[model samples]
Target: MCVDSPLPHLDRPFDYQVPAEAAAAAQPGTRVKVRFSGQLIDGFVLERAAGSDHEGKLSFLDKVVSPEPVLTPRVARLAREVADRYAGTLSDVLRLAIPPRHARAEAAPPAEPPPPFTAAVDGLAWHRYVAGAALLRALADGRAPRAVWTALPGEDWPARLAAAAATSLAAGRGALIVVADARDLDRLDAALLRVLGGPGHHVALSAAAGPSERYKRFLAVARGSARIVIGTRAAAFAPVADLGLVAIWDDGDDLHSDQRAPYPHARQVLLARAELEHCAAIVGGFGRTAEAQQLIETGWAIEVGATREELRRSMPRVVTVGEQERARDNAQAAAARLPTLAWRAARDALNAGAPVLIQVPRRGYLPAVACADCFTPARCAVCSGPLALPAAHGVPSCRWCGRPAADHACPQCGRRRLRAAVVGARRTAEELARAFPDTPVRTSGRDGILTSVPGEATLVVSTPGAEPLADGGFGAVLLLDAWAFLTRADLRGTEEALRRWFAAAALARPGAPVVVVADGGLVAVQALLRFDPAWLAARELAERRELGFPPAVRIAALTGPPAAVAELLSLAELPPGAEVLGPVPAAEEGHERMLVRTTRSAGKALALALKTAAGARSVRKAADPVKIQVDPLDLL
Candidate 1:
C-alpha cells in the first residue's frame, strides 16, 4: 500500500493485509484506508503480494475507500518517476497526478461511448513547415516522432494541434494535449470539436472546472471513453490509454510550472511520458525555450519550423525603435513610453479599419513609484515594501503590507513627493484613450481580462499573456516599456521578454506592423524584428552552456533556515563533480539559499542523494524543513 503521506521518510510503499470482508475491493489501483502509525490514512493498493517481506505481522487495511479503481499502474509509475526526478516524495507527486475523489461523480452512470470518428488528415496546415506533414503522417502510422515545433505567426495553432490529435485518433490510439491555461484549452476544445465532429471523443480538463465536472471528465479519460484529452498543466498526467501523441503548447509559459511540491513542468512531464509510453510528442509554441532547444541540440527531438520563404509570407513586419525615430523624438522616447513612431503605427492601423494591440509589462495603474526629488524608490516605513499608486491621484501605498503611505518619504532622498516609476496597463489605456479620443479603447489585464475583440478601428491595451484575440488579428502590435521585461533580475529575463513579444506579435495580421520599443541592436529586439525565436533560443542556450547554467547543468535550490540548509548539505551524499554555490541570504527573512550544481549526466544521482538526505532529516523530525526545488525557474 502506498500511504498518502508527504513525509520523505515514509515515501516507500508498505505491505498491508486485506481483511477478508474487503479482499474483493482491495485490488491494485483502488483507493483504501489503511492504518499507518496507529492512525487511519488513505493509501493505494500498488499490487498484490504472495507473502509479506516483514518478519512482523502486517497491519490490516482499515477499509476500502471505494471499489472503483482511480489510480492506474501507468500513472502510478509516472508519478514515481516525477517524484524521483524532482527530489520530491512520491506521495506529493501522486497528489498532483490525481485529483481529489468526487464520490457523487464516480457513482454516476458511465458516460456513453463516443460516436465513431474518422479523422480527415488535412495536410494544408502542415504545408508551411518542412517536416510538419511528416509528423502528421507518423502520428497516423502510430510511429513516435518527437519534435520541437516553432509555430508560425498568425498560425491557427489550435486547428493544427487538433489535426495532429485527429491523426493519432485515426490510428486507434489516444492523444493528450496540455496547453498553458484555460484560454488555450478552450480554443483547443473548439478546434477538436470541429475536427473530430463532437464532444464525446475528447474531454477538456482544468482545475477551474467544478470538482464534480472535473472528476467526471477525468473518469471519462481514465475509463478509455475519451481518447483525446486537452487541458492545462495538471492534465499532463491524464490517464489516456494507448497514448499515441503528447503535445504541449507554449511550453515556456510560467503557468506550465506547478507551484506545488515536486513542481514538475508540463513540458518535461509530457516529454518523459512520451518516452515512457513510446509515443509521439510535439512541443509547439510561438517562442522556443532553452530546454526545448536542448532537446533539439541533444538529437532527442527534431525541429519543425517554417522555411524562410513561408516565414516571410506568414509573419508580420517587425521593427524596433530605430535611430530615426529616436532622433525625431529628441531622446525623449524612453520618457514617452509610447513614442511618435508607435503613435503613427496605431494611427495607420486605425485608418485601415483594423484594431491595434498594445502590450504593457505591468498590470495596475502604477505598479511602482519613486521620489520625485532624487528619483529614489518610495518605500513603506513600516514594511520596507515598494509603494504603488492604485489610481491617478490615489495616495501611495505599500504593495506588500497594503498600508497607505500617506506621509511617505524616500529613505534615500527624504522627498515627500512621488513619481510613477512604472506605468502599467490601466494608465497606458488612459493615455491611449486620450490620444485616440474618437476610437474605442479597451483594457485587458488583471483588473478585467478579455478573450477576444471585434476587428474594427479601436485600440486594445493589455498586459502580456492577456491580449485579446482580434477577429482578423490586430493590424498593429506595440510592445511598450521593453526595459521592464529585459531588465528583470531573473536569468530567463531576456528569454521571457522575447516570448511575450512573440506571443503579442503573433496576434498581428500578416504583413501588419509590430513595433518593439527598445534599442535595435539588442539581441532580443533583432530576433523579434526577424521573427526568429529559434535563433535567439539557440544563442541563449549556447550562452547558458558556456556559463555552466541550467539545461547544461542541473542546479538544485535549497532554501530554509541557515542551520537546516547546512545540515541538508552536510547529510547529502552529493554526486561526483557537484559544485556548491552559496548559503546566500534568501528572500525570506532569517533564511538562506544554497545551490548545488552537477553535470546533466549526474542529475539523477544528485536528485537521489538529496532525496535520501531529505528523508534522513524527515526521519529525525528536523525542526526546520528545507525547501528543495530542482531546476527552479528563477535563479538570480
Candidate 2:
C-alpha cells in the first residue's frame, strides 16, 4: 500500500493485509484507507500479493475508498518517476496528478464511446515547416516522432494542434495536448469541434470545472471512451491509453508550472511521459525556450520550423525606436513612453481600419512611482514597501501593506509630487483613448481579459499573455516599456521578455508594423526584428552552458530558516563535483536559500542524495522543514 502521507521517511510502500470483505475491491490502483502510525490514512493499493513481505504481521486495510480504480498503473509509474526526478514525495506528485474523488461522478454510468473519426490529415499549417508534413504523416502512421516546432507568425496553432490530435486518433492511438491557460483551452476546443465535427472524440479538462464535471471528463478519458485530452497544466498527466502524441503549447508560460509541492513543469511532465510511454511529442510555441533548444542540441528532438523566406513572407515588418531614433528626434521623444514613431504607427493602423495592439509590461494603473523632483522611488513610511497609485485620481498606497500613503514624502529629497515610473495597461489605455478619441479603446489585463476583439479600428492595450485575438490579426503591434521586462533581475529575464514580445508580435497581420521601444543593439530586440527566436534561444543556451546554469546543469534550491537550510545541506551527501551556492536571504523573512549545482549527467544522483537527506531529517523529526525545489523558475 502506497500511503498518502507526505512524510519523506514514509515515501516507500508498506505491506497491508486486506480483509476478505474488502479483498475483492482492494485491487491495484484502487484507493484504500490503511492504518499508518496508528491512524487511518488514505493510500493506493499498488499491487496485491498472497504473501506478506514484512516479517511482522501486516495491519489490515481499514476500508476501501472505492472499487473503481482511478490511478492507472501507467500513471502510478509516471508519478513515481516524476517524484524521484524532483526529489519530491510520491504522495505530493500524486496529489497533483489525481483530483479529489467525486463519488457521484465515479458511480455515474460510463460515457458512450466516441464515434469513429476518420478525418484526413490536413497538414496545411504544418507544410510551412520543412519537416512539418513528415511529422503529421508519422502521426498518421502510428510512429512516434519527437520534434520541437517553432510556430510561424499569424499561424492558426490551435487548428494545427487539433489536426494533429485528429491524425493520432485516426491511427488508433490516444493524444494528450496541454496548453497554458483556459483561453487557449477554449480555442483548442473550438478548433477540435470544427475538425472532428463533434466533442465526443475528446474531452477538455480544466480545474475551473465543477468537481463532478471535471471528474466526469477525467473518467471518460480513463475508461477509453475519449481518445484525445486537451487541457491546461495539470492535464499533462491525463491517463490516455495507447498514448501516441503528447504536445504542449507555450511551454515557457509561467502558468505551466504547478504551484504545489514537487512543482513539475508541464513541458517536463509531457517529455517524461512521452519517453516512458514511447509516444510522439511536440513542443511548439511562437517563441522557443532555452530548454526546448537544449532538446535539439542534444539530438533528443528534431527542429521543425520555416525557412527564412517563409518567415519573411508571414511575419510583420518589425521596427525598433532605438538610439538612432532618439538621436534623430529630441530627448523628450526618446523619454516619452509612447514615442512619436509609435504614435504614427498606431495612427496609420487606425486610419486603415485595423485594431492596434499595445503590449504593456505591467497590468495596473501605476505599478511604480517616483518623486518628480529627484526621481527617487516612492516608498511607504510604514513598511518601506514601494507605493503605487491604484487609479488616476487615487491616493498613493503601499502595495505590500495596503495602507494609504496620504502624507508621503521622498526620503532622499523630501519631494511631495510623484511621477509615473512604470505605466501599466490601464494607464496606457487611458493615454491611447485620449490620443485616439474617435477610435474605441479596450484593455485586456488583470482587471478583465478580452479573448477576441473585432478587427475594426481600435486600440487594444493588453498585458503579456492576455492579448486578444483580432480578426485577420492586429493592424500594428506596439511593445511598450520594454525596460520593465528587459531589466528584471532574473536569469530568464531576457528570454521571458522575448517570449512575451514574440507572442504579442505574432498577433499582427502580415506585413504590419510591429514597433519595439528598446535599444536596437540588444540581442533580444534584434531577435524580435528578425523574428528568429531559435537563434536567440540557442545563444542563450550556449551562455547558460558556459555559466553552468540550468539546462546545461541541474540546480536544486533549498529555502528555509538559515539554520535549517544549513543543517539540510550539511546532511546531504552531494554528488561528486557538486557545488553549493550561498545560503542567502530569501523573500520570506527569517529564511534563506541555498542552491546545489551539479552536471546534467549527475542530476539524478543529486536528486537521490537530497531525497535521502530529507528522508533522514523527517525520520529524526527535524525542526523547521526546508522547501526543496529542483530547477526553480526564478533564479536571481
Candidate 3:
C-alpha cells in the first residue's frame, strides 16, 4: 500500500482477508486495489500479517495488479528517507524509481557493435586521470565507493566518464551514468562505446527514446544484463545489479531533477544510493557547484584537481564585455548586439579559417521585447501577449497566445509600430547574418537545428540547451549578453551562467580566445579569469549561508492547491523559532500556494503538518498532495 496510509502507523495491517483462489497472487510488493474509507485506493502488499485492530468486517484484496515486485528492501529504505527528507509521499518517490509496468519489457534488438580499443591498463597512471582507479577497485567488489564528491572540469569530461564505464565491466560490476541532457548522455555513450566493442555494453534511456528503445534498456538493467547504462535524469534508478558506479555528470543542471512526484534530483538519489548500497559516485562538471564542494569540505570526499601548469596550458583567453560601450548613432540600441571586441574576435577567428561559437540566452524571434515609447514590453489588448518580430512574413504576432496579426495598435498609444523588445537567437542570427553578409551564418540552436555547415567564416549561433560545436573544437567562443543571465532573480542564475561560460570555453582549444562579454568586476567573470571555481563556490556559499539558503541550511518549498495548501500550513506542527512565511498568494492565479520556511528541522515539522493537515474534512486534500522541493535548483 502507499506508505502515507494510516494503516502502518496504526500498529496493525488491515486484514483484507484474501481468498484461497487469489492467495498466491497477493504476495508482498504486489500492487493491489483496496477499499479504504469508502474509496478504492491503490496499495502495495507490505506483508500478509494475521491480525486486525478493529472489530468490523475485513476487506479482500481487489486483485494483484502486477506480479512484478519492484520494491527491493534497499530501495524501500531509501524511498522512505527521500519522502521524509523532501516532506513528500513515499509513493511519490516510488513512482520515480519504477517506471510504468508496460515499459518493463524488451521491445527492440541490440544496437550494432562498437569497435574495441586496446589500452595498456598498467601503463596508465592515476595522476593523469580525473577518475580514480580506487573507484574501479571498489566497483569490482560489487560495492560502491564512499567518496563524498570531487567534481571534474574540462571539455573531456564525457570521454573520462566513458572510460569509467569501461572499468565497470572489467571489475565485474555494472555502471549507471546519469547526465543533464540527452546530448551529454549521447556523448558519454559514444565515447564509452568506442571503448566497449560489444552490442550489449550500453544503452540510452530517456523519454525521447521510443517505447521500444526505453523498454529494451530498462529490461537490460532490471534483468542484470546490461552492465553500462547511460541516460538523462531518469536513468538514476536503473536496476543494474552489483552497481559498481553511479556517475552523475553536471549535477547542478536543473534538468537532473524530475518535475513529477517526489521531485527527487538524480544527484540526491545517487548520494543516497551510494550510501545505502556502498557504490562509488563521480559527480563531474566544468564548474564546481557548491553542493559538490560541500561534499569535499565535509570530508565525505577527497579533492581531485588538475595541475597548475596543465590548467594554465588548457585555460582559454578570458575577456570582459561589460566595460565597453557602443556608440551606434551616438545612442544605445534597445536590442544590444555583440560588442565590437567580440565581433572582431569572431571576425578574426573566421578570418583564420576557424568557426565561431556564439552563446545567447533565449530562442525564437524576439522572445522578449519592449515598447519604444514607454520602454516596457508591448502586450495584446484583449489578452496580454508577449509581442514578437515577424520572421517568416511581414506580420508580427503575440508569442504568448499566438494571436495572428498581433500588429494591433497599442491601447495606450495610437502608434501601430512596436519595437523589437528582445533579442532572441533567431533575431540575432538574422541581424548577424545581415551584418556579415559575406559570411555563411547558420543556427545550431534549440529550434531543432543540430549542427551547421563547416566553413571558415561560419557563425554558429545557439541557445543554452542546444550548444553545439563540441564535437571538434571552436577557435573562438563568444559569450554574449552578460546582462541576460546575470539579471535573472533566481538563486543559481550566476552559478548557471558561469557554468555555461566555462563549458563553452572548455569546448574551445587550449589558449583559444574565450571572449567573455560581461561586467569586468562581476565576481563570476573574475572567478573564471582566475580559473578558481572553488573561490567562486565558497563565496557563493557564504552568501547563501548568510541568507539561510541551502548548503548552510535546508529549505523546503511546499506547493499545492490553494485551500488545501492553506489548510496544511495552519494544521502543521512547526517547531520553536521555526516560521511559516507564506500562505501569501502565489503569483500563479487560482493557486493557493504557501512558503513554510524554517531550519533543517523543518523537514520533520513539515512532515507532521502534512500528515495531520491532510486529515481535515473541509479540504479533503487527499494525503497532502503538495510538491516539496529540497535544495531546489529553480527558486521561481
**Which candidate wins on lDDT?**
2
Q: 226-274 in candidate 1: lDDT tens per residue?
A: 9999999999999999999999999989999999998889988998899
For model 1, the superposed segments whose C-alpha errors exceed 4 Å read 322-337, 412-414
lDDT (Cα, tens digit) per residue for candidate 2, span 87-139: 99999999998888999999899988977787676768888898999999999
- For model 3, residues 1-636, the per-residue Cα lDDT tens digits are 453253212212456777777788877766677777777777777677677666998777777776655555566677777766665567767677766655335334434433332342231333453445665555455565554333333346666677666676667666778988877767777777676754566778888887655765676666555668888876777777777788887777888888875577888888877787777787777787888877877777665566667577767787776736543542213123767677777878878877788888778877755666766667766568777766745566677677765556656666676676667788788877766777777786755866434536578888876766543467788887767888899888878888877777776766778878788888888987877777788788888879877766666566777766665667667666665556655556655555555676565665555544544422453553555565566656
- Candidate 3 matches the true fold with a TM-score of 0.87
Q: What would the TM-score be for candidate 2 when compared with the true structure?
A: 0.98
| Every candidate's CA RMSD | 1.8, 1.7, 4.3
The worst-scoring run of ten residues by lDDT in candidate 2 lies at 327-336
Off by over 4 Å in 3: 1-43, 47-58, 103-126, 129-154, 327-336, 404-407, 410-414, 451-457, 560-563, 601-605, 615-627
- In candidate 2, the residue pairs with backbone N, CA or C atoms under 3 Å apart (3 or more residues apart, or in different chains) clash, namely none
State in Å the error of residue 493, model 2. 0.7
| C-alpha positional error of residue 482 in candidate 2 after TM-score superposition, expressed in Å | 0.4
Pitting candidate 1 against candidate 3, the one with the higher TM-score is 1
Better of 2 and 3 by TM-score: 2
